[model samples]
Target: QAQIVELQKQLEEVTRARDGFQTELEQAQKSNTELTENNRGLTANIDKLSRAQHEMLQRARRADEALRVLEGEKEAADRAQGSANTKLATQEKQLKTFLEANEALESDLRKQMQRVALLERRKLEQEAEQSTIEAYYQARLDEMQAQYDRLLSEIDDSKRAAQQEVYRAFDDNAKIVPPSPGGGRSPPGKAR
Candidate 1:
């Protein structure tokens, strides 16, 4: 009978151990179900992060391309501005030279005008002097002609007076003057 009680106690202990093992198995299965759900959520988050990273890389590449295009445009604008500055400087120099040349030409023209005025004045003076000299010579020629005419008239009057005196002297003497040795003053039959 004591051996029978010991056997019954051993059987009861075995049944209790079996019941604890069954509880442990049930807890393990419940934990496994929760862990599976957590793993699925983690995987979804990883996929979302990877997609965001890819979009950021695409945006960065586009920004770099935009920066390169802007740099090229700036260089082109700078080169154009430099050329414009150089041309402006050249045009300014040319304008200054033209202005100086025009001033010099104006000065020369003024000098030429003054010289022409002086020459015209000299010509007028010479013409006036020539007129004066011609008038003086004409007056001298008129005085000389009047004096010559008077001297000729006086000589003619003296000749006429001398002829009258000789004729009177011959008449008073009352002598016949022979014209030549063969011709008497009157003919023989016609004595005067």
Candidate 2:
């Protein structure tokens, strides 16, 4: 009975050792599984972070290009505004010149109008003088024509009186001679 008791105790101790080894092995296997799951989670998070970083870089590049484009547009707008201002200034100067020229032309027109009025007055005065001279000449011509007619009538009367006196002289000087040999004065009776 003593030998059997010693053998049973030894057998129990051996079984307990076996049970402890199995429990320790099971715990190690559970830890290994948990560690594998953690490693997988870590790998997935790293891949997500990498993808987010790449997207951020691409967004930054696009923002830089947009900024450059906006800067170019702003510069172009500034240049256009400058050109418009220059054109406006040029137009203003031209308008001023045109106004000055128009004023000068108006002044010249006024001077010409005054000159024309003066000339018209002078022409009227000259016409009046010419008419007066013509009237004086016409009166002189009428007087000369009357004197010429009187002289012609006086010359015709003198010619007729001279012709009558010549006839009377010729009748008184003529004498009648006798038919006999002796010449004697003819009597009022008939000659024998």
Give the CA lDDT, 0 to 100, for residue 3 in model 1. Answer: 41
Cα deviation of 69, candidate 1, in Å: 40
lDDT of 1 by residue, 51-148 (tens): 55455455545545554554555456557786566655554565455456555545655554565555455556655655565555555545545544
- The runs of at least 3 residues in candidate 2 whose Cα sits more than 4 Å from the true structure, single-residue gaps closed, are 1-83, 158-192
**lDDT agreement with native, every candidate:** 0.55, 0.55
Question: Can you write out model 2's per-residue Cα lDDT over 1-192, one digit (the tens) per residue?
Answer: 444455455546555555555555555556546655655665565555555545545554554555555555555655788656665555456545545655554565555456555545555555565455555555544544454454445545555666766787677667855566444556558675
lDDT of model 1 at position 17: 53
Model 2 TM-score relative to the real fold: 0.35
How do the predictions measure up, each by TM-score?
0.43, 0.35
